[model samples]
Target chain A: MRYAYYPGCSAHSTARDMHESADAVARLLGIDLVEMKGWSCCGATSAHQTDRVMAASLPAANLLLAKEMGLDTVVTCAACYSRMKTANHEITSSADMRAAVADAVGQPYDGSVKVRHFVEILLEDFGIDKLRKRFKKSLNGLKVASYYGCLLVRPGNVTHFDDPENPTSLDRLVTAMGGESIDWPHKVECCGGGLNLTRTDVAVKLSSSIVEMAAASGADCIAVACPMCQASLDLRQKDIDAATGKKHHMPVLYITQLLGLCLGIPEKELGLSRLMVSPAGVLKALQPASSHQV
Target chain B: MTIKIKKQSGKSLRQTVEEMSGVDMSLCYQCKKCASGCPVTKYTQSPPSEIIRRLHLGAGDELLESDLVWMCLSCETCYGRCPMDINIPAVIDALRSLALEKGSKSPRGDMPLFNRKFLEAVKAYGRSYDLSMIMGYKLGSGSLMQDVEKFPSMLAKGKMAVLPPSGAEKKVVKRIFDRSKQAKGKKK
Candidate 1:
């Protein structure tokens, strides 16, 4: 199946592994990812706070671009998926409000394109059984905590692809790839997004709790859908350890990375080296004799 | 110290905070998940969840006097974890603004001055320059002895860059900042 893809800003920068792993998986699944050209930021936590119109407009513009391309958009990043889905919902459900927003943007938004999260597309379209059939190698005995951060689930109808309170899309995906998924509290908790800029201390504390909880729940690694989530859990873990005087060195992996590994993709191609905590040991435990060179 | 209740406006503190910030303060079930997950709550008397509860109790005057409001790093963990999706960070920010407007002094005297220093740094550079921010904070707080040993290591490791990364359109960022400040001023 062919779908228009929106990688979002983080996919281009810190979380480039997400894009790489996604591309590898799409190729393996025979899915065509046509990237939306000249796309802008999703306006994440900032735009929604400062200006509602701008927030809606940014995602709306991306939707319009996808519509122009004549395909339903599949977003890899959870935050992008949430923003795009929210914009689509608003434009379709509320006519008067949609008209005002369209007027502000000087474009007619007919809400033609459908926004699907990568996980949704995998579950609904690709199916977990198909993923299992495609897996050349299994992630046996790998304990993973499937963390679905706030943006992907909350605000209800906007992102109606899954049960926000108890999302199991990632868990199903992990199981399909032969990994054990752990049930843990703080799975849907916020990683304190852009608040890292204004409140590093707060970000560290919140992120640390998530890691601690995941560890307590017997998770060897935390699997995340958002780049910001990965960043908070991976990059700031050292600071959390320093502040609390406890060592938390859990390797955080993008769900797509795990999928790629299960599909027998080489570790270097998956950009496993880019991660702060090496996923080599984790990968080796998942797949014996899988020495991660480089 | 006896806790004295003051009678004032028709609306309670909870009502006012909810109306202003669009956060349902009563939705906070006091799970203290917010406090438990909070980074800076350990340094404050009242945690974020407690502050929200106080506001819900119509303790507007008393809420304003809280150090909790100023202590919030606005990391948005509370908002992210909240089942109700209440923007707790924004509510805290609103409370801080209200306290400043009402001439309520921070129980921790360094907080207000630290905020001003951050704003001043942002205004001047159109972005946060960490060294300048740290210097400003130290000068404002009168605590230079803190973390002095780590500074050399940080500089050596290139973690503390002397200058911010280039490519920031200073004029455009400045305009955005100015516009937001003006809008905030008008609201005040």
Candidate 2:
């Protein structure tokens, strides 16, 4: 019931909704999330690409804290989860590498800390049946495209969370909330991620296809776990549409936000309005159409 | 787009990549599976498979200088699909590090700038300070106008804070960066 929460940089910024709704939902479910004190960045793509030792060392510092706490680390950002898991895999797999990381971090870590993505925690820690019983409202008539993006389920051996090719954890979560998770091919595709800052054109080109495919699958909105994917699909959506010459007004919602909505959490409290594309249309579907006097 | 294959001598590219990345590209047998699975392959002149192929053919410097390495999304699709279990992302990471270390100008645009600023922010604050990173990125990359319209709204919604956050372990983070820098210097 207790987890050392490692909400990455995104949780404080662009994807605040994911962090807020995750806290709200976990509290409602009787799960305690203790924020890992003095935790730093996970190094993300920048560290690994720049220095291998620093990349592994950054996550090692956090994992050492988690080990000290004697609790499993739960990460909401897929990029952070991937980095931490990769660091864990690398450090544990090689003695020399482990020593180098320990030397850099000024502490020896045995990689004993278990890193779990928020999706995995929701699925494995909080059983689907138990979650189903707790839903106060239904997501009926809501068709959602579960966007896994890349990190959460890639390099199968290192992540070991779900099938890298085709994951159904998000779909199962959607189904448990009385919503339909659309089957789509672009579920595991790259959203150009950090490339948004480095290469906006590529991000737009890649995110456009994801949005187009989600809409083509008849999804009212896209559910994402990673803030990078959420930002790509939500913030750059306007550019994607402008470039593609398509009017796909698809709303991107975090998986936590979607779950919180079904749990009857208020929209504002979940930071729903922070999304670039408005999720109002999809949210309004919760009410009977006949009841509205429009 | 003809890749002039020059058979070079003395510590081949494959050996260097393998030594640095700990991933033996010699295990790659022209499967092209990695290239096929790579999402950014279309964006690059040479795909992951071709990069490995060139490395297999004793290709060097060219692969390092190529934009293909910079364009790699590092999505790990290639790594996951490799039958030989070749970690392509790690290899590309090694290539990137080598390229940057050698003072080779990045052919793929402002990625190096953004990455440098991002890490600089992390080194200073122990985490990414969005406002500072943006300002630094804008100054370094001159991308001031991009995504400018969303600033006010993001600020109003409390999505981005105007001030930077000093993480509790800033000194520890500084030490980590210093150690890595010293280690890299020793390696050179």
Candidate 3:
């Protein structure tokens, strides 16, 4: 399966590990992930919040490039996925919006391109049973909280990706990779996103709640699909712990990184070392001597 | 307790919200379902239900002025929970856009400044340059000293790229902004 990959901004900077791990995992999975050439930003939360036209047109600009390539676009960032999918939804739903987007982008776009989250690609393109068979090292019942955050499943009509309330895609992925997906209510909770940069107080409150819930649920690690969620949960975790005066050292891992590990890819290659909260203890337990295969 | 409803004559704020958001404002019926699921409702002066209620009451610039609009996470929990499927985020987005247009004074800190800096980076670099965004935001937000302690660690960890990424899509991105502004100008 071939895809025009859209790595968004975080993948290049803060979430570089996610990009590297996803790249490695794609190679191992035999999926051809040719990056969409010189792909621009998806306008993310900022664009949509300020200007509607820019929001639609920014994603439309990238979608048009993918359309030219004649391959469906696969996005790793949940925020980017939401923006691009919403752009496609808006363009396809209304001719006026489509016309405006075309005018702004200086190109005709009928919203013909399909934009999919890479997690969806892993599920639909590579079957669960097939992925299960390829796992070299089973997670051996490591409890994982599949945190979807906001964008992956919310505003159901626009995204239409998974269940808005109770999404099981990440859980199913965790299960397929031999980990125990913990039943947690905060799976779809907001991580305070960009507020992590602007307002640390609010970000700390929201992030600490998420981390506390994951820890309280007995999760060894929180698995995320969005880079922003990863940053919010992992990078701000220390501050969260400090703010609450708790000793919860919950590690956050990208889905790609976990999949890479189960497939026997080295931790370094999966960008494990780049994680703010160390996954050292978890990784140590997953080694052959201490590991249990089911 | 008796509720004093301010009945206003002329164009309703509900009509303005509907026109701005393209969502039927009347679809919201004080169900409070949106407020119940809202994650940030505790922080806002008026939750989702109250925002819409005020809109129905023809409350004008006050709705735009409230910290509630800016505080909204746009997480769409309320939108998802609403049985009426009112698109609460979209309505909030409209309110935010209006706030930007009107330069409505907000008590909600530096979110608006941060958003503007983010888009300015996008407009300039085709994508967000994290270092530039951080630098610009710190300067614009007048808190250059806030996250300074984390910079060395960030650079060491490769979390912040030193150079801006160049892409062939930059020109087209700039054109997109110019064209959108032009289109909006013509519309007005």
Candidate 4:
């Protein structure tokens, strides 16, 4: 299967690991991810709040580009997927909005291209059973909390792939990769997103709750889909600890990275080190030899 | 003491909450999982579960003035723990928006000031510049003297950049702002 890919801004910069793991996983699954060239930012939390039209238009432009390529677009970032899906929904549903958006971008948005999350591509297109068969190293003992932030699931009409309220796609993916998934509160919480900059105290407080809950649930690490979610939880973890005076630091990993590791991809290549909290211990714990050797 | 049975206005608070949040408020089966997991509820007059229960019982007007709306960090703990998947944060956001529309001031004194400072920071800079945001918050909040020590370190570590990053597309961003304002005006 081939997909026109939208990596969004974070994938190009801070969350480059998502791109790496996604590319690796795509290659392993024999799916072609041709990136949409010269794509701009998706106007995530900031854009939508500041300007709804631009938020929808920016992602809609990318969709127009994808339609030009004549293939469905797959977005790696949850925010990007949400924005694009929202834009797609708006354009397809409202003729006036579509015409206005098309005029703004100087391209006709025929609403032909479909926006898909990488998770959807993995589960629906690639199939979990097929993924399970390819896992060389099973994450047998690793307890992972599947953290699906707000974007991927909410506004269910646009996303449409999973149960917005009780999403099991990521959990299913983790289980297929041979890891035990933990039930934890804040799995679908907003990881404070761009609100990190505007409201540092609130962001820290919010993220701390998630990390604390994950630790309490016996999760060694939390797996996530959105780059922003990973950054807010993983990068600001130290700040969260400082604010809350809690020592809990559960490592945050991309679902693709977990899948890549289970499929026997090297940790360094997947950019695992980029995380503030190292997943080496978690990875070691998952390996069978570490159990007997320790 | 008998709790006074006030006559409900006959509208389902669950439906109202769902309409505002895009979350099915009916999913909350009064498990109190949300209350158990909530961080801010400890600091608020009402816990998250109670807030939902009140909303479920058509206590819509009461929620408009409740301190619980402003206190919500939008952490989404209730949404995650809710077996029925109720998005408490969104419901809170909706309530806060409603309060803002109704000209209801934040009872917790610092919160409204914080909101104004935040919007000022955003309005000045296309994107939020941390230094400006912090300085604005401190000045507006009268907490400048308290956090004086941390400011210098934040600057040294590059955590707080001097200038805000320009919006990705400034012209377009301005247009969005203007249009949204116009949209709001039209709604009014």
Listed per candidate, the RMSD to the true structure in angstroms reads 6.6, 2.9, 2.1, 6.8
- What digit string (tens of lDDT, one per residue) describes model 2 on residues A1-294? 899999888777777888999999888889899999999998989899998989999999998888888899999999999999999999999898899998999989877799998788888988887888777777775899999988999989999978898999999998777778888899899988768877788878988889999988999998999988988888788788898998889999998998888878888778888887899877876642221111
Order of models, best TM-score first: 2, 3, 1, 4
Per-model TM-score versus the true fold: 0.70, 0.96, 0.96, 0.68
lDDT of 3 at B18: 84
Model 1: how far residue A263 lies from native, Å: 1.0
Taking chain A by itself, what TM-score does each prediction score? Answer: 0.94, 0.96, 0.96, 0.95
* Interface RMSD after interface superposition, each candidate: 7.0, 1.2, 1.3, 6.0
Model 3 lDDT per residue over B29-134, tens place: 9989888888777776788888888887677766777777878888989988898888888888888887877778855567888887888888999999888887
Question: Candidate 4's residue-wise lDDT over B102-148, tens digit each?
Answer: 67765543555555554454445434444665577677766676536
DockQ score for model 3, please? 0.74
Stretches off by above 4 angstroms in model 1 are A90-96, A110-112, A288-294, B1-188
Reference contacts preserved by each model:
0.03, 0.72, 0.75, 0.03
Worst 10 residues of 3 chain A by lDDT: A285-294
DockQ of candidate 2 (2 decimals): 0.76
Report clash pairs, candidate 4: none
Model number with the top DockQ: 2
Q: Model 4: residues >4 Å from true position, as ranges?
A: A110-112, A288-294, B1-188
Per-residue C-alpha lDDT of model 1 across residues A242-263, encoded as one tens digit per residue: 8778997799999999988878
Q: Which of the numbered candidates is closest to the native, going by highest TM-score?
A: 2
Estimate, for each residue in A13-108, the C-alpha lDDT of model 4 and write its tens digit. 457678888888788879999987656566555444333455567677678668879999999988788778878876787777777676556666
